[model samples]
Target: MTYDTVAETDPAVARALEGERERQNGTLSMIASENHVSEAVMEAQSSELTNNYAEGYPGSRYYGGCRYADEVEQLAIDRAKELWGADHVNVQPHSGSQANMGVYLAVLDPGDKILSLDLTHGGHLSHGHPANFAGQVYDVEQYEVDPETGYLDYEGLRETAEEFDPDVVVSGYSAYPREVDFERIQAAADAVDAYHLADIAHITGLVAAGVHESPVGVADFVTGSTHKTIRAGRGGIIMTSDEYADAIDKAVFPGTQGGPAMHNVAGKAVGFGEALQPEFTEYAEQTVANAKALGERLRSHGLELVSGGTDNHLVLVDLRSSHPDTTGKDVEEALEEAGIVLNANTVPGETRSAFNPSGIRAGTPALTARGFGENACREVADLIVDVIDDPDDEAVVAAVGERVTELTDEYTLYE
Candidate 1:
């Protein structure tokens, strides 16, 4: 898409926009929570609905001239319900973090206890980090994965739930590589008479396509990001039974957020429509397969993966065992220079600071979106290893960059 209209108004911003588009076309995006949406979704997101304020649900907006807005929002809601099978769905919150905040506002009183995973152990800031509003308002305790196995310790979680007697137990994860047993977590929440909020923010599409176990019926509330595995535009979604529908709607509208982003809701409608197609199932399945291929190749090259391998679309590599002196930041920077982009994430039992952590996290959603298969993913893994093995070697970096250029060209994005 040309940015000529934007350039007419602001050349500087237009240039940056074009540069970002070029960068996405050039580099490999392996960030676990990122994806490339279809052009239709982008067009919907850039629609003129951005100027409208639809302050309420369909058929009950507080403003006039909301007929199209109502139609778009209702379509988004219907598609989300069909995708996730929830009795009630809220597609309002601006982001996944806002979705979590809406849930907190819906049920809990100030100072109520929350039990969630530790941030360094694959949890998100919205769950209960000190910097987030949830942490400031709630009494929070954290659980951890097993240090040795790098898997969630369900038995230990049960014990913690019993002892902490939290009001809400938060499941789901940001950087976790394994499939979560939402039923198991719900069982613990049930035993303690606490609510279970499964934040499937990262695996929404995988669950929708049945590649990953769903938390919809199992958990009290299910929240997700539409832009991750779902390949939708940027937005957050919350699903619950009809019993909590009104509470959630009120919390999202008059509680945590103002008017919804109608344009993004339109984008969601388009993206969700696309996901319901038969090919999306193939895409989801291929995403997981490619991740397994990438992880297997990385492990074969002597990198230590958290949990030994992946059950989903992401793999977290703990570098302490394989390269004690090389930090994730070092590898992250070198890999970016070589045109393969991913994030430096903290592993379970972390010994380094959060800024420059001990592990790297990579995923296959965007690559798979660009038609990369298992062999391509393995080759990408090899390139990653080459750079990590010799970050300072100019020749190695140059060679890897050349290969990345070929792959990006071979499986062209935004063409």
Candidate 2:
């Protein structure tokens, strides 16, 4: 037979569920790649679809009894296409890294040249980090941010592309804090006849909500995560123009992955539906506002932010400017002790090592979605700055942590 609700019939499982809920309630999740999905999305993600083993795309599945799976997967595909205006959409890749890998398999050989942004200068590891498969499989060249401005060095990008003549030029970032110049990048890619792949994993929701520029039609390929800013279930999507549809589809299916996660695909459809609403555009705009507010507050307290501040949802604080004696690990630990969470990131030209880099990466999406605004972010900034500047002051840290709980407790996210 079948079991009832795990929480209702199993005492030990119910206790574990309660414990997990408490942990989420007590901690602050400021990780750039994470967010709390809506209840609707969560419901779909936890549905019975998780038990299915539909081994292929909708109509051509390798298994029978895939009627519901077909409907759900196709809905996700159609909604993604409508949302981004893409000629094709594949919601099968399990993560952002997988999406990028599928693109590599689609267009380039193992020894083919690929150019991307450097990790320290705001690029993702999947783009070309030496430790990743991309670097191992291809001829990887990197472009750095402007030494003076700390923004992208488009001129340098052009020069590098012209000289290296990479088959693909990847555009996207993990630590970047400003708007990307997609048009300029398109021109640079055109100059060298390189295919432009825009991995808008972090900014996908913003682009979909119209707060950021859409790369769907402009770039040769666009890849994104379904969770991060989209607040959907965890998965990845690959989209492209009609010309590359067959290549992209083949790359994702037999090339890089097998069956899609039907549970997550259902959740993605709900998220795309939410994104189509006008409210999502407003939410995207508020994320930017909250980030800028937090950035200004941090700067006012003698902390120097990368690029002087942010133009988007992220803030990269170069802690060396304020705590020349402290490292990013020290601050991340201190903040975690004070009920705040964020990642330590590498800053451009940082003299510090990557393990304990000079900067901390924070974002506004999760907090803003929890109903946090500019004033609340200022308070958060003060608490973060206090913890960093006075890590040894246990009393001060405790007080800041208490204040953070008080501020965040007022604004509830999903249960």
RMSD of each: 0.6, 2.3
Tell me the whole-model lDDT of each prediction, alpha carbons only. Answer: 0.95, 0.88
Model 1: weakest 10-residue lDDT segment is 406-415
For model 2, residues 72-129, the per-residue Cα lDDT tens digits are 9998999898888989899989999999999999999989999999999889999978
Q: How well does candidate 2 match the true structure, expressed as C-alpha RMSD?
A: 2.3
Per-residue lDDT of candidate 1, residues 1-415 (tens digit) = 7899999999999999999998999999999999999999999999999999999889998999999999999999999999999999999989999999999999999999999999999999999998988899999999999998999999999999999999999999999999999999999999999999999999999999999999998899999999999999799999999999999999999998889999999999999999999999999999999999999999999999999999999999999988999999999999999999999999998999999999999999999999999999999999999999998898999999999999999999985
lDDT of 1 at 246: 96
TM-score of each: 0.99, 0.96
Report the Cα lDDT for residue 195, model 1.
Answer: 94
Off by over 4 Å in 1: none
In candidate 2, how many Å is residue 387 off? 0.9
Best by TM-score: 1
